[model samples]
Target: MKVYGVVAAFWLSLASATILQNGQVRPNDYPSTAISAISSYNSSWHTYSPGSPELSYKGRWDHKYISWWSAPGLKFGFQADQVAISFGKYTSDGVLVAYRLGGQDWMLTNVTANSTHLFVTPSTTGYNLTTPTNVTQTLELRVTNWAYGVQIQCVHISGGAAKLVKIPDYTRTMELIGDSLSAGQYATLEGISSYSWGLLYGLGNVEFSITAYPGICLHEGRCYSNLHGQTAQWLKIPDTSGRALDIYGSDLADIPNWDFAAHPAADITVINIGTNDNNTANNVTATGYYNSYIQLINEIHTRWPQSQIIVISLWSGFSQVGNTWQQGAGFLDEIQNVVKYFNNGSLNGRGECSSCFVYYFNTTGILEHSDIGPLYHPTDVGHVKLASHLMQYIKLTFGWILEQTGPEVQHDTLYWNDEADY
Candidate 1:
């Protein structure tokens, strides 16, 4: 496979068109190895561009240092299926992590304040994710953080261009199942920024999937309701019978299926739900939610017995019923204990300490805006801070090798054209 260039203009023009069949994973030439080499930072060229005319933030905005490198002749069409992404710990505030393909949002996932703080120690915490449909596309990792200090490595990608059209390569996959956060709203436009992007960019070597709904909760089918002074949608019944956008119900239509094609040969699964659980009056029982979480882990294990499971908390946003400092902290502690009890197996030496395997990320920062979005969701900066925290932990837990990517290729600056902008 012949690799290509890494110039700013190259990436900008490259990003414009449908980047299909340009990213592929080969097993023969590619060895199943973890990258642990670190690359020195270049202040001038290792960070994301300052701002975008189309996007704005309410909190302080700053980007972290990032580096990457692509393989030769490894052109993936916009239709290559089964793309896997994993990465090292990202240590920065409010960072947006993801593995991007062309412009479409695949393997949509994020590391919130809670996930970041819980696992942000000096270790790497990661997930194996896959996309729902089969599309040939380029695999690119993007980060959104204020400052930077971490290394990322792509471990694996399965199959060729036609792999997606037939049956998506079944390498282990993790479903980012949750509400708007997982669905990736205001977080960043589809291809611009996302938690899934970080997963993809960091773990450029794995195949994963995404099963997120814009306004979904874990209570079967529901939305988040107001908890504390915040207003979160609740899980309710949608009025399909009526026309206007008034009626609401559990709408899992956007949820992906369990077909073999969609399911990868996953060995690591992650579930980050529950914020919306406390949204409505019919709040899901913490114990019951814990029980259901265990069952979900079991079901996934049954499919991929050797897989490692991780249950993450929602990024900080609205407070729940008893969200006072001490009460909230205690509630999370209990949830963490329950997760450990379920997935604590024999020492498997997956690198991370088994005891700390099942993790928890709490929203540490207070939101600056109470009404950023319609239902009072966090603004772009809020998501960035959360991603930064999670990336830090992932790097520490997994000593990932850094990619020797050239200067931070600011696509906007490279492709800026006064004539194009009216």
Candidate 2:
């Protein structure tokens, strides 16, 4: 892959078409459009150039939900009767295109890949863009696959040219690190419009990243031999075997590591692990788990010194295969003890990181009552519940105000009265 410095001309070449601004067609000489890695965007995982503008490498671990480009002044152009998007090297079975039109809520549309250069006319699901023409809108796009990648070359409008504007940088950034639950494995099983908790939590102005894999565990040599040693593995790009591939080859062999310096550090990092660690087949002891947990936290602190790390408690639902409810409780207890140990300065050596915290959200009510998907994974409703609980926790812990309201909770009368198993 080619590496380019942060030069002005690099960003300018992306805008190949003219845009309308302030009721006038701006000259075609402006920069193509601002294309930068924001939230979950990572440049190392894919390849890009002028010829194959948005091509991505094909491999097992290359799957990711990368944010391609953000156009800020979309509201400036004439009301588009139709919008056309072009993609290159499209390999995914299907890709989800999410965008916010005008001031309305974010909408999801799925585009099926047909060939190398695929053109798609997405359905305007939520807000009608045909009636409104003179409003400013911000557009963001993300790929849905966690193992395959896609490239978005450009977007066009039917009525008038789209005015490319600067992408807005949020005041705070948050990162969620965990396994399938945090990755929204089955949130969309019910429907394509379903959203993950990470996306819902980042609804408004908060930039966020979801670094997770479905079957990943906290320790190595489990479920999949390709798993990494700790949760920190997701911070880097993975190879075919799910191992962290060296970011720079040959010349940088001595410094073979992901250049985290290129990515923005998190202000609040929430970790939800241990579900896979509790596997009976893994035979991991309580002491071993605690040591691994603390090591992961230390690594996170080293990466983002200013980050407030929040270690989430294991969601109280299912234990690993062959484990009973009592064993699951014990696992949760061990995790709680580990959190206390770190908070009390017993593990950190240095005094406790006052900003660090632990939060518990009981999943028993949601999962045991069938308010979830197959394998007891949280469905759309369950994700919303998790997000709502986390939002309240964030408000109380950090005193941060909600920038936007999340999706409305869908309560099922049948399961509303079910007793929580945990």
Candidate 3:
């Protein structure tokens, strides 16, 4: 967890114009006459940066209207941590290109749009220019046919050089404990995207480490006789050499003894285990899974006395585990009750009070398939949906502004290398 302070320094450019008010997009700022100019506030011409565009199961083209303005040079002085473009292709070859600042015609850049029906964040390059230059910035859709049009949900801008007071690094350090889903497998065709990993990767700042096994069920009785290998594999501490140990029952004895002194204590801990426990046909008991979950929660809370614990119920498509219950009704209902119970319990000294919160978000197995990659994990689209949901919850509970969910846009080109991990 390295933290650094950043400052946004501005340089004078050659172009000049009356400086606009200090804020993000203001509705009327866009040109109403340009083709079919779509602004954020369709009702009121005030808000500029849109919250989020509605994602599609299939394909739909949407675009936002942008205007050309002059401030003197080719740069509009703003810094963001990450940027995302909510757009879709009309035909086969519709690519969103970065229009060079302060230019009339659209100049093409090498940013490739993702095939998934979601907004994709382009790889961050380095600083836009050695020094800031006053220029007009906007996005352009480059399609094979001039008449063909695509739809853009919105443009997300965040994490740039901090202006005014020096801004510190804000990527939350999170600890995830669960099964294959939490491990971030099978989200995309190539398994390149998982909901967890996508959240970590998509956000401008956030570091994550996963501790999960592939086939282990959350219920204690479901543990097979050969649980030793699976348990050892699940807790194989990254970058650590350890001995193989058998894990019987739901008691994660090995994790408690592991040294966490050097590792940055997790700020957020997510527990997503229960898909396998609900493998019964038609009959399932909420109380049964709840009791085991209570024990697991108690154990996790006992160990990480200060970390926040969040429990997630499995997404739709998973079947109920039992002979009498077939659908997800009984299982999810019970799980929600358990979460509500545990959430209240945190305030009663079970976990970190005032700071801990538990929530259950509905996820879909199909959303994972939308990734361009071959794995079944959540695609970038799926991650965005999850992020939107999580961000709302976190904002309401923690009373913190979701920096990425605001009205603002700044053009940036960050040079990123695929070989390195940030």
Candidate 4:
């Protein structure tokens, strides 16, 4: 196992004005009504810079163009019959971006390299962005899917190009930490983005910061000789090497530290790791994993005392062993054991200790055979299934369910890739 001791410097963008204030959306983030929306339409494309306060940002850094790991997104209001977007693509055609405008149903489309993708909000029962329908329309977009590298420029409003007034409304936030199962694979159709999207639509008012990559582990040391542990990656931005580095940077030395104080502490943090630790050739022991995870838990506690940390086991259990119980040959038991240690062997530990910060949910049989993708990870179908169950769990345990249940997935573009092993 290789040890990494180098601490990367922090990179805080001066241009990220759309930043979260005190880890929460600034009240009435939208611009004052003193500056009215453009009542008339424009024949030319009206452009705005990404740093414009009119644009609200979350789960991302401020840059000339925005791109990073997990689901970096925006929420803003505008007046336009059509919207055109341009983005920078490093390797693959930046695709699988999810969007909703004019309160319409969610739509999925690919933002091809060096090209402008035009989006026309369809006429739903309540929404129609056209001249007669409404004076202003709000747009919510998230690059739930990552395609190697992406740099999103500004949006161009064709007709009613009003100043983008970003409005963020959320009661709490969630931080999802994991590896390939959490981060989509190379050119994967949709990462666990659907899961986050499901939570967004179902819960109605919450935010998610996805701190995950293709091949990471919870314990230190290494996995695939590249992925560093969560302790290292959590504080840095993701690079192109299936790792986290500065978005413009190319190597580990250029990795930039993420500012936790600038962002909000997670009300709920879901940790799904350990698969790589067990699968790696390093032959990590459960004791080693136990210690490392304890470290992770300790850090989380120190950062957010009132946070609920849910540790989940790997979905893909190893090959059937002994015929007694069909599951993986990895650290599923040990992972749960660590949770039990904190819970004092009591399944309902919260009742015993009001301050108990840890909880465990065994996902041994979460995914069905068909839902499992080729890489031994959950496919789009599998992700939705997983999200549904997670939502159900949160509702039952903490009574946090809202009106909506799940996102309306785009059937045509529904194959997302994930997971990896030698």
Clashes of each: 103, 9, 57, 5
TM-score of each: 0.44, 0.63, 0.42, 0.75
Candidate 2 clashing pairs, residues 3+ apart or interchain: 12-32, 14-32, 15-32, 63-146, 63-147, 63-148, 75-135, 75-136, 75-137
- List, residue by residue over 104-149, the lDDT tens digit for candidate 3: 2223322222222211112322235333222213222322111122
Off-target runs (Cα >4 Å) in candidate 3 are 1-171, 189-192, 221-257, 281-288, 318-330, 344-356, 362-380, 400-422
Tens digits of per-residue lDDT, candidate 2, 248-276, equal: 22222332344557557877877777666
Better of 3 and 4 by TM-score: 4
- Between candidates 2 and 4, the one scoring higher on lDDT is 4
- What lDDT tens digits, residue by residue, belong to model 4 across residues 3-41? 111101111211122323224543323211111122233
- On TM-score, the leading prediction is 4
lDDT (CA) per prediction: 0.34, 0.45, 0.36, 0.58
RMSD to the true structure for each prediction, in A, is: 20.0, 14.1, 20.5, 11.0
Clash-forming residue pairs, model 4: 23-264, 238-244, 239-245, 317-328, 318-328
Q: How far does residue 313 in candidate 4 sit from its true spot (Å)?
A: 1.9
The superposed Cα distance between candidate 3 and the true structure at residue 108, in angstroms, equals 24
Please give the RMSD of candidate 1 to the true structure: 20.0
What's the C-alpha lDDT at position 197 in model 2? Answer: 39
